[model samples]
Target: MTSPQAAPLANAGPALHAPLLASAQIVFAQVSINFGAALAKGLFVSLAPEQVAALRSGIAALLLLALVRPWRRRAAFSRRDIGWCALYGLALGGMNLMMYAAFERIAIGIACAIEICGPLAVVLLTTRRPRDFAWLALAIGGLVLLMPWPGRAHASDPVGIALALGAAACWALYIMLGRRAARVGAPNAVAIGMVAACLVTVPAGLARGLPALDAPVLALAATVAVLSSALPYVLEMRAMGQLPSRVVGLISSAGPATAALIGFVVLGEALGPWQWLAIAVLVTASAGCSLGTAPPVSKLREEPLT
Candidate 1:
C-alpha cells in the first residue's frame, strides 16, 4: 500500500533470485489478494461486512501471533516509538474497515477504482513532471467512462463513496506509518496491526454476528481470513521484497481488474463493454505513469518504517 517497503529490499532485487520464480510470486500474490476479496464477499450474506473485516483481522492476528510470537521477543523500540506504531495500527484498521464497507455498497471494481485515487494522488504530488499529468487525465477519463451520471432516481450511495475515499486516504497514511514502524524494527507490523484491528473490530463483530458464528460459519470465516488476510499479506510482502517499490505499486494497479474478474465469477457482478474499455484505459494510465517514468536513484533509500 505505501509502495511496499522499498529501501531495505530494493537492493534485494530479482537479480539475486530467479527471474521466473520472482515474477510468478508477484502474480500469485496479486491473484491471492483478488481471491481474498471474493471470499470476503462470500461471507457477506451470513456476516455483516464489519464482522467479516473483524474476523479476518482477528484470525490473521492469532495465526501471526503463533508464528511470530512478538510477545516473546525483546523490546525492539524505545518509548518514543509507541506513537508511530499506534498511528500505523489505527490507519491499518481504518483502511480495512472502509474498504470492506465500500465492497458492501458497490461492485469491487468500481470501489477499488475510486479508492485508487489516493495512491494516484501520492504519485502525482511527489513528482513535478508534466507528462505525469497525462496519467491523471487518463485516470479521470476512465472514471468518467465507468461512472454514469447519478440522478436522484439512480444515485449510488454517497456514503459508500466517501468511505472508499476515506479508505484511500487511510491507505496513504498506512504507508507512511508503516514505514516508520518498519524503521523501529517492528517487522511484524502487519501482524500486530491485525491484532490491533481485531481489538477494535472483534467486539463490534460479536455484537452483530455472534449468533451467526456456528461451526460452519466459523470455519468459513476462518477460511476467509486465510484467503483474504493471511495469504495476500504474506504473498504481497514476499513479492514486495523482490520487486522495486514503483514497479510493485504499478503492478498492483491490476487490483481493480482482478477484483472485476473475481466480482464476475463470485458475485455474478457484470459490466457493460464500455466499462471493460474503461478498465483498460485506467490500467494503461497507471502503467504509463509507472513504467515510463525512470526509477529514481533515491528509491534505494526508501524503506518501510514499521
Candidate 2:
C-alpha cells in the first residue's frame, strides 16, 4: 500500500542517482587516463612522441573495432554522423599527439594544467549562470597561477607551453564533437572515431621506421592503449551522453590535480608550493561546480550503442 507521496519519491530515486553515477564515471576515467599518460611518457625514452601516439591510437582502434564491430550497426549512422565521428577522432588524434610532445618538455602535471584550458574555454562559452561564472573565474585564476613567469627558475619550456595550448584547443573540440557523435551512439561513434584517429596518428609514427617492436615496448604500448584510450574513451562517451557539456567540462577541472598526484606517484615528478596551490584552486572550482542539485533526468539524452 504505497502512499501517493511515497510513489513520487520512489519514481525520483533513479533520477537522483544518475548524475552521481555519471560524475563517478568521469572521475574514474580521468584517473585512468592520467595514469596511462604517466606510463606512456616512459615510452618516450625509446620512441618518439609521434610514434607513441601512433602506437596508442592504432592499438586502441583495433581493440575498439573488434569489440564494437561498428559495421554491424552501420545502418544506424548517417553520413553526417560519420563526419562528426571523424572530426571527433581528428581532435582526439591531435590532442594525444600534442600532449605527448608537451610531455617531452614539461612535467605531465604542468602540461595537463595548460591543456585543460581548452575545456575551460568551452565551459566559459556555453554556461550563462552567474554561479557558473564564479567557478570559471576560479578555474581561470588557477590557470594564471600555473603560467611560467619570465624570470622564474625551472620555468617551463616555451615550446612546451605552445604545444600544450594546441592540445587544449583539440581537447575543446573533442568535447563538443564527442557529444555530437554520441547522439548516434557511444560505442559506434567511438569505434569509428578511433579509426579516424589512427589515420591522423599512425602514418607519422610508422615514418620513424617501426620503433623497436620488442615485447616490452609492445606490451606497454598495448597497456597504454587499454587504459588511456579504450577504457577512458568509452567511459567518457557514455558519461557525456548522460550529462550536459558544461557540467562535463567543469567536472574535468579535476584533471590537473589528478594528473599531478599520479605524476608524483608514478613518475617521481614534484611540484613547487605555488604549483600545488594552483592545482588546489582548480580542484576547489570543480568541487563548487559539482555541489548543487543534479540536473533532471529528462534533461539527459541516452542513446544506446546499438
Candidate 3:
C-alpha cells in the first residue's frame, strides 16, 4: 500500500509532464505549417496562388469534416454560433489567400514576418497595458528594417508587402472571431469554419480555371492540406486545451524564424543579416507581448466538443 505522500507524487507525474507534451505538440504544429507553406510555394510553378489556396482549404475542410463528423452536434449550435464560425472561416480564408499571393512575390520568411504583426496588433488592442507600447515599437522597428528604402540592396516587392499586411489583418480578425466561436466547441467551430473557408477560396480558385490533376499533384495537394491545415489545427487545438494561452503564444512566436529556416532549406531562399535581425526583433516583440498580456490559465474556459 502507498503512503499518502507517495500517492500525491505519483499523481503529479502526469500533471507535470502535460505542459511539456503540449509544448512539443505546438512546436511540431509550427514545423508542419511552415514546411507545408514551402511545399505550396513549389506548386505555384504549375498552379496559381489562389488555386493552391483553394486546394489547401478545400481538402482540409473535407478531412476535418470526415474526422469530426460535426453533424451529430448540429442541433446544439444556434444560428448566432454559426455566424461567428462563418466569420472566423472567412478571415481564415482571406488570410491564406493573401499569404499565398504574397509568397508569389516575396520570400516566405519575410512574408510571415510581416503577417505576424496582425496578432501582435490584436494583443495590443485588447489589453490596455502601458508596456505594450514597447512591443509595438519593436514591431515597428522590425518593419522599418524590412522596408524598401531607395538605397537598400534588396527590397521585397511593394505589392507583396501590401498583400502580406492584408493577410495580417485577416489573422487579427481570425483570433477575435475564433474566441467568439470557441463557445460552440472547438471541433465543431473549426469544422464548420473550414467549410465556410471553402466557400471563400474554392470559387476564387475556380475563376482561374482547373489545372491538370494528376495523381502526384493530387497527392501533393493532399499533403499540403494535411500538414498546413488539418494536422496543425488538430495539434494546436489539443495543445491549446492543455497549455496556457501565454505558453502557446510564446511557442508560436518562433513562426517567422521557422519559416525562414524552412525557406532556406526547401526553397534556397536566403536573407541578409539585417533581415535576420528584423525577424529576431519581431519574434522578441511577439513573445514579450504574449507573456505580458495572456490571461491566466485559471481564467481560460475549455468547452468540450460533445
What is the TM-score of each predicted model, taking all chains together?
0.82, 0.81, 0.93
List per-prediction Cα lDDT, in the order shown.
0.68, 0.78, 0.84
Best by TM-score: 3
Query: Candidate 3: worst 10 consecutive residues by lDDT?
Result: 297-306
At residue 119, what lDDT does model 2 achieve? Answer: 50
lDDT of 2 by residue, 185-227 (tens): 8778778888898887888788778887899999999999988
What TM-score does model 3 achieve against the real structure?
0.93
Question: What's the C-alpha lDDT at position 76 in model 1?
Answer: 71
Q: Give the least accurate 10-residue stretch of model 1, judged by summed lDDT.
A: 297-306
Model 3 scores a C-alpha lDDT of 0.84
Candidate 2 residue-wise lDDT at 213: 81
Tens digit per residue, CA lDDT, model 1, 1-306: 335677558757655665546556666766666677777878888889889888877777788777666666448766556566667777777777788888888777766766666556666767778888888898889877666555423234567767877987877777667667666554466656667666566676677756467888788778777776666656656666566756665667677788788889988878667667777787777666766565651131121111
What are the C-alpha RMSDs, in order, of all predicted structures? 7.5, 4.6, 3.1
| Stretches > 4 Å off in candidate 3 | 296-306
